[model samples]
Target chain A: MERILYGDNQFFAVNHLSDSKSQALAVRFKDNEAIIRTLDHAREAGINTFMCTTHDRIAQICDIIRANPEKYKDFKIYPCMPYAHKYANAMTDLGIAGTIKQYVPGNLFGTMFKGGKAFISKDYVSIMELLIDAEMKMFKGIKTPVIFLQNVMTDLLLGLGMVDLLKGYHDYIITKYNAEPGYITMNMPKLLDTLEAAGISNPIICASINKVNFRMSGGKEIYEETLRTRKFRAIAMQVLAGGAIPPKEAIEYVSGLPNVESILFGASSKANIQNTVSTINNFDSNKV
Target chain B: MAVRVALIGAGKMGISHLSILGANSNVEVVGVCDTSKLVLGALQKYTQFPCYTNHSKMLDQAKPDAVVIAVPTKFHYDFVKDALSRNIHVFAEKPFCLHPEQSAELTALAESKNLVNQVGYHNKFVGTFQEVKRLVKEGHIGEVQHFEGEAYGPVVIKKKADTWRSDPSEGGGCLMDYASHVIDLINDILSPVKEAHGTILKTIYSSQVDDAVYSLLKLESGASGLLSVNWSDETYRKMSTSMTILGSKGKIISDANELKVFFKDQKCPQGYSKGWNVKYVTDLAGQVDFYLRGEEYSSQMDYFINTVTGESPNTINNFKSAWITDKAIATIKKSAKNQY
Candidate 1:
């Protein structure tokens, strides 16, 4: 049975998904003395789980986590990798000839890679092994759990095979490493539906809400299906959608959404952080 | 007896006070004085009260029960002193005097005359701060630990480069211009501070006076405070007052607009133990309504009239409170560049 806990039952999970990847993390990371003290302020506000894209400056992330050992003891971190990392070894084993950069753009751009071309990507197995190994090493001796968030864009191609690929890399490291596997949902509910079709059930997924990619009807169906079939843990991404939404109105809008455990946002300054913190203070699960 | 009142200096603030006093049924504004006939001309359209070009003429002709002194900061001491000398209660707008000695003189004069004296720090009567004060008094935020206020908006200087405010002769810097609100905030939350460190910046604006001010106030009860007053940025006009009170058991954070209390619920550490629930009450908007009424003038005017008619048993007919604002402004001005 899919464990679908709701309404103040699960920990609130927030991911720093500002689209700038490493540069964004470096700018917002606490130890860098950035204008916005994201990690420190969030920890002070008692956010339990934090996720971000793998930054080039992993040392700063590690230093921040290490410095505030007790303060962020319960907080979890999830690192999101680009979609291309999946095709490394599989295509090579299959005698496919191409540059590493060519295969990555295919996975990132949905129309380019599908069916045979996606399955035959030479770097798939090698990239999976690399990611699993990096994660195992990155999460070593960490008392708080580390989770790998799999993008739910291409289940027929790569995403559904993640558990098996992770296992093949480190001999059942999927279960052995005590790593949590989460998924990020595209606007298409069929992607999630395909996960169930591939016997990959109960995936924890983060959903993005934005102008260009929002299929609310599809989102609600997938959310309900996830609640019924997969783990219903959701971190609301794209809450502000690149600052297009006013902070206060965005907060009120997010708080009104269903199945939202946490909202991920970024700030440019301390004042922004303070204002955001105040806005989030408006969230009342009971009202929802 | 009619509730006679005279407005000293028929300027912007004086005009506002006169209008508010005129609106109130209990007030009868008797006279108005201004050095400029233009100011008197504007006052005449607003009120039929006798207008004088001199303070002595206005006070003598009107024999006003109370006086509203809206003159320049430097002249506050002399005008307030004159008003108190006649045993007339004084309702003076902020920065009662530029110097502590001048303020002290006014305070002594008010005290000696037993006049109903009140200085304008009208923000205390504002709705948001009133709610915060009530919450603090009710132990909603625990023991008040820290307070930080930031009032930043576009610069609003009505005069030219050679204006009195820029001359320092008229006490025109941000320390006097902006510190009035900060000082009132300090008075409301923490008792008057014994010592404070301040820094002023003349950046961004073309005027000779400081446009930005940052001050660190050491409250009598050891609560630390920071008041950052800026007049440069135009991104948004925001006036925010926040107090974070860390008590032995719980913490209360008052954003001046709303109150958030962090007390441990009896419930065990569930998944949602650390989150906050927001309550929306409409008390804050109501306070703004009360302040917009210029209720200070009405209250002070009524008290002055009541005292003059012996309707009230006791009155502040002297200058005690005027000196308090005066000294606070002087201290802030003196330490304007001293950063802590």
Candidate 2:
């Protein structure tokens, strides 16, 4: 796991802090070149991995990376699956069958047949795998050492008690994509228990781990206890807690935690990226 | 004792409610009802809760203390009425009913039965919006003179096949689906829109229904504002609802995620400064037992379930408030018809 992972939120205008800021970012990264520039800045700032959602625009990013294989040979992307809006918009544009035919990666007829079978038999796991394949299509020929299931689907499955689907995602990613499966969830304690019950040992989980307990479902103390007592790899995200905490304080808090193998953050500027990287490195060195 | 709850519709929002209800320690999901055999089969296979195709059958057998209705807006009237008449607490999804009259009737029925009724305008549960309400009420942004409520999303960027969301009769369109949220937030955070004029329901993408809604509104407090909402905005990754209120003393800008307030002088609320003060949803939002898309989603369900269990007062997001929103929607629709 990379010690620092750059997230895609800022590039995609997913500002959890201010709408105006999000609008600014949306304008700033309206072009794909701007996003590429920011990635290059992060790479120069000593970050190697980019954790991003499988938005349609990301497909273009993947194409750019594939084109410049020499420049980004060691650059890795941890692709998160089921960029939900793409499917939702597609579902509205095309019906269920149409969406499946459009996105699922295979012969059109075979994909349709599989979709039909899954629908009829209620084989949700199969459908899940098909959707995974479809979402993974964009990351083809890229270095995705770890694949993540976005929290929207992960927490939903957790709430539904559908741990089998989680396990299915885990095993399928390993066997098919040959990447370690990571679960991004708001409820880390419950997800850990579910993963344990599903026999997914030492799973990689990413969640909001901040000093303020922002978006930490079961609260900060529980997360701290789980990190101390658990065996799984943890990736601390939202360390700044939607800009509520100062960067240094936030990174210090996350770095002081046990079993946190990586810290995930997003910034659009070179200065912010360098500052965050240095802060994390400083906190980590102090801990060591 | 736990509140025995049954769910109807079992669509996207319905399943979300069912999941939250399933996780609530104060509630037990007694039955699930939906017309789709596929959805019911999946539920039956995975969950221990009983599943039924007929809502009436589910209601009769489950004998729930409360029921959640998440069907299409057009069906909300019938389903909610049935649940209310059964002396069951009801939590129905938003755009409470297709027409204001139906919403009024349901509101009356629920009130007469003394049953707990809630409409899922989940934005009210958003912490930043809640803080907006507080700041406005506490006169941090004194005397809101003008305001603007806007919501945009990429739900329908292209000319698409007709779904329930594309049909106006089914309570689709930007007016009902998107603008209603902003209207409700304006009503809750500031004041109810008393009148609307210069309304324009433009069909940018959808053939049958309006894709964007623009109007000038007058609140009950005589403060006026603008309403601009479009569902065809591809720039937004999802629905982004925001409100900007300009006042005599200060100003406020809020969205689902954050709240920003500008006070002119030192006469500001505690923990807030004279100049620009910003608060994020993470700082304002309360924790929930189970979380999905956002804390607001689970928080709304938790509030409804708590109200059903009599643990909390049925104050916020009641049917009456939703009726106010429906009336505002009707005002906009009627005003749109008179556009030049």
Candidate 3:
């Protein structure tokens, strides 16, 4: 993981704070070139790692990267699977078979039947794998050092005691993609314990790490204690706590943590990217 | 002289062609494109040839003399058309495309470019089927009156409701994958199917698409036939294709291995008076360099290679025949009576 990883939430119009800003963003980044241009800006700011959800638009972004390999040779992507909104919208628009036809790979019906059955039977582990493969299809030839299970499914599994699935996902990333597995969750502490219980140690877990207890299950104290003592690679996200904390204070609090490995943030402009990068870097320099 | 070929779709058939086409010294497997990184990554351990997951991206780089499409029948048009637009030749799998209009457009494009196009109706070159064609042409069967082509298999048995072979959108189902060969065989011997009336069943095995398709086809040569195929037939050992043809004078029974003819004192090829004459596939007149999947797969590639180099003319399941197959299938769909 890079010290500062660029996120795709801003590009996809996912504002944790305001609906108006998100709507503006949806209009703003509707053109894929706008997303690509912002990604280039992030690259210029020395943020080479793009932590993104596997939305349909990301396919276009992958195409841009693949088409111009010279420009993106050293770049890496952390592709998160089961972009829930995309699938939910697809199900609404195209219906069940149509959604499966669009997502499932290889033998459409053979794989889809399993996926559909898994959904009904709550054998979500197999469905997760299929969804991963389906999601991984877009970034086929691109460099993806880490593939993530998005929070919508990841936390659901966490809440459901589906630890076997966590292990399965972990194993698949290593075996199929030859990449590290990442899990994003709301309750990082519980997820870590489940993963550790399931034989996945020193895992990469992305969650809300901030000054306030904004969406931080188990509270800020527990998060701080886990950061200090846990044997895991912690990628801090939602550090600004949906704009509750000031930028400087958020960066300072998260950067000064004991075991946080990486900071994931999203920005629409060059200034915000530079500011975040500089703030984190300045905090690190001042720590000594 | 090597014919540079880029193969798209690294499914089971793609892998088969990869090994077979690689075995060909006269052809270069320039690039292999599939949507699966696992498949492409797996290919890297063996061959140093270029591999990609996107066809257009691969085409931009490979720029080969020809393209081979071993993808599902649904994707035939786009990949084939992409290659044809570049004035490059293409060889696609059966059921040329999902629709007649697209098939006509691709056929016209390929023809306008004068690019060699072949579809993988490997049964056409199967020795027994070839013999059946030969026997029919020689008037041994004597003006075929009707034929029944049946393709039953365990491929989609037990409601294989979730494979590309079972999805209607993906150009799956028993008819597209299995029955197309028998249809093409009838077309090869008699004439193209001009129209069809049929019933397609999706609920027999609870498939997303039709698991079983039964149809009566009207041939251009004024012959009519029945096609009974069900992918969900679990009684079969595996896949078995058998065609029974009844003619004015005699009849022919053909399967994968044996060609049987029962003559009513018809044209006997210096064999006997009036009885059943059966010849196995080993009695075929030609030999292949190598046999993978079937001799026809290699023969098809070899023929395509030879055609590319001007060694042979484009024959055996060209795109026009594929177009007719496409039209016939569309007609079957349009003609099937609603069960509601």
Candidate 4:
């Protein structure tokens, strides 16, 4: 887990605070060129890891990164899965079978054979592997140290008593990809409990941890409690709390936590990027 | 007592099975399950049998002797496993298990449990195709040297976001949906495929499913087969499948409803002085209890029920046969996609 990990939400127009801002950003970064330019700027700012959602457009970004490996040799990608919109749209076009079919990795029938074998043996973990491999197709031969489950699906599966899938993810990331498994959730406390019960310890968790509750389920107290006491890595996100808290206070409250391993934020401009980085470092200096 | 049956999908083919099963008096339609609420609502109007959204609950409560699974290709693994593990016979619609590996496992389980397993390769039961099989097996077409199978339709020309068939993932497109019929026919009349090689072209719906699938097959019997299928052909008046089998002494040509046999030497079977003998499938269909699409649907179900009751020796479209077809499909798609 890096101390400062750049994010792709801003590049993909995913602002939680305002719909208009999100739409505006979508228009602003509609071109892949703009995305590449911003990503280069982030790289120049000394942030070497881009934790990104596996949106369709991200495939192009991955292509650019792979093409210029010399430029991105030190950079890493933390892929997030089941880009909700892609799945939703795919389900509409292909139905459940077709959508699953599309994600079957290369060697069409070979994947089908595995898909079939996985189905018959009730080896759902193998199917999960297929999906993970499917999502990671574009990032082939690139550096992916960690893979995160998108919060929407992670929390939904959390609610469904499908903790085995989360555990499967953890086991697979370690066994298959040799990468760390990460989870994003609005309800980190509950997820941690579930993961712990699934026998996963000291896992990397990304969540909305801020001074204000913002989108944090069960509020900030339990999040703070987990941060202080839990044996896990924390990547604090939404620290600005839907733009309610100022940057300095947001950074201070998040950094003041006992075990914040990383901060994930996305910005369209170089100034905002520099300012956020400075604020976190300044808060660390003040604490010292 | 009626044979207890449960159905686990409400898609188009599922609904077809529902219709045939509903009309059959030899079986009890115990339950129906589907993922979509609207499809469930539609099934509700057709059966007094209970409906469920989850397969596990339906199986637990219904405790059916047999399961009819018509869900998408991806979901076949779970439902089939659940049924087989519980020692239930299964009648799954084609492309069976989406892969040969899955079929091999499921087939082993069914055989281990002494449970009946059948895939819906309905063309095997069509009157004309049945005739072709008879002639081929009886040596009316002596050791088929060359074979060409074609199926054309207008179902997938435009962007159809309304149906799952337009998408490749859900087992969509011409190869899985249409050409599979041809693959099965090649297996039925000739021999199981020893080799399958070819590619698919996505002309109209490039981003979705392949619109066309073309394959070359070498049957274990040394007969060669060609497949040219296009689901996006708007010129097709209706969905149609046609085939031509060339043999040493004669030839056989057939479409959905008719078969024509050509004997060059006039050394044909008992009732014919055949240069060319034509038979319309309508003249061949025997009396059947319930028939729609083809008598094949009801006929095949009847065969499965008999196998379940130990009345028939075996079904021709068993999971083993489908395993071979899935293998061919996989080999062809691999060759095709790799080309791209």
The candidate scoring highest on DockQ is 2
Ordered list by TM-score, greatest first = 2, 3, 4, 1
By TM-score, the best candidate is 2
Question: Whose lDDT is greatest here?
Answer: 2
Q: Candidate 1 has what TM-score?
A: 0.48
Q: State candidate 1's DockQ.
A: 0.01
| Deviation from native of the Cα of residue A259 in model 1, angstroms | 46
- Which residue pairs of candidate 3 clash? A107-B164, A108-B163, A108-B164, A109-B162, A109-B163, A110-B162, A110-B163
Query: Which residue window of length 10 is worst by lDDT in model 4 chain B?
Result: B38-47
lDDT, candidate 3, B65-172, per-residue tens: 988898877778788888888888888877789888999998888888889988888888777788888878888778889999888765544533255665778886
Query: Distance (Å) between predicted and true CA of B41, model 1?
Result: 1.7
TM-score of each: 0.48, 0.95, 0.54, 0.54
| lDDT on C-alpha atoms for all candidate structures | 0.52, 0.87, 0.76, 0.77
Per-model chain A TM: 0.61, 0.91, 0.91, 0.91
What fraction of correct interface contacts does each candidate retain?
Answer: 0.00, 0.51, 0.00, 0.04
Off by over 4 Å in 3: A1-288, B198-202, B271-273
Can you write out model 3's per-residue Cα lDDT over A117-187, one digit (the tens) per residue? 32322333445577788789999889899989988667645543446667888998999999999998767
| lDDT winner, 1 or 4 | 4
Measured against the native two-chain assembly using Cα atoms, what DockQ does each of the candidate structures obtain, in the order listed? 0.01, 0.50, 0.01, 0.02
Local lDDT at B183 for model 2: 94
Off by over 4 Å in 1: A1-288, B137-140, B157-160, B238-281, B284-322, B336-340
Question: What DockQ class does candidate 3 belong to?
Answer: incorrect
